[model samples]
Target: MEPRLDLLSTRAGGDLFTMLVSANNALAASPLPRATQELVKIRASQINGCGFCVDMHTKEAAHAGESPVRLNLIAAWREATVFTGAERAALELVEQGTRLADAAGGVTDEAWADAAEHYDEEQLAALVCQIALINAFNRLSVIVKRPAGSYRPGRYA
Candidate 1:
């Protein structure tokens, strides 16, 4: 399938892409565990219905040694046995954050408290940034109808 627009080809898109890449790099260098980052990225992508992102993050996670079992279970994380309490908390945050419109009050205090229990202030900051960044990327890709299955890990590195 062809994309509706080539985001990278336009000047405005090039600027936006640079900023997004910088944000992503900041999150990547944060205190949050790489595994948790991948899981969060995949989960947010899944929730946003961005196939391009889902494909990209899943492949990146696998390349970084994430097991197929865990990758496959992200969509059903609430019922899965393979995740840590911290990972589960992050996933919950991602869901609430991504689907903010569905919940009247946005992310609940309970969810924030749970995440606070698992992560320090700095890590929590990074986690929030990561979730927001992925959601933005998902919207961009989904809106553009970007095709999936061509991403290679480290392509932009």
Candidate 2:
């Protein structure tokens, strides 16, 4: 399959993609754990059905030493035994935040409180930004019908 738009080929699209990449780099410099950040990205990608992102993040996570078991279980994280409390909280936030149109109140207080229990303000900020960023990427990829299974770890880094 081919992408409907080559975002990197056109000047406007390339500029937009560059800005997103820059924002992602800034988020990467935040205090959130790398493993957790990958997991959050994967979960949001799954929710968004962005196969390109799911494939990208899973490979990136594995290259970063994330266990196959944990990566595979991320979609089932609510019942999986492979995550920490903070990771679970962040996952919940991912679900809530990604499915914003499905819920009346958006991210619930309970979920925010749970995330706060496990993360500092700085980490929470990172988590929120990462979730939003991944979702944006997902939407872009999905809208363009970006095909999956061609990504290599660090290709975009």
Tell me the tens digit of each residue's lDDT in model 2 across 52-156: 999999999999999999998999998899999989999999999999999898999999999999999999999999999999999989998989999999988
In angstroms, the error of model 1 at 120 is 0.1
TM-score of each: 0.98, 0.98
Q: Output the lDDT of residue 5, model 2.
A: 91
RMSD of candidate 1 to the true fold?
0.7
User: After superposing candidate 2, which stretches have Cα over 4 Å from the reference?
Assistant: none
lDDT of 2 at 36: 89
lDDT for each residue of candidate 1 in 60-119, tens digit (9 for 90 to 100): 999999999999999999999999999999999999999999999999999999999999
Cα lDDT listed for each candidate: 0.94, 0.94
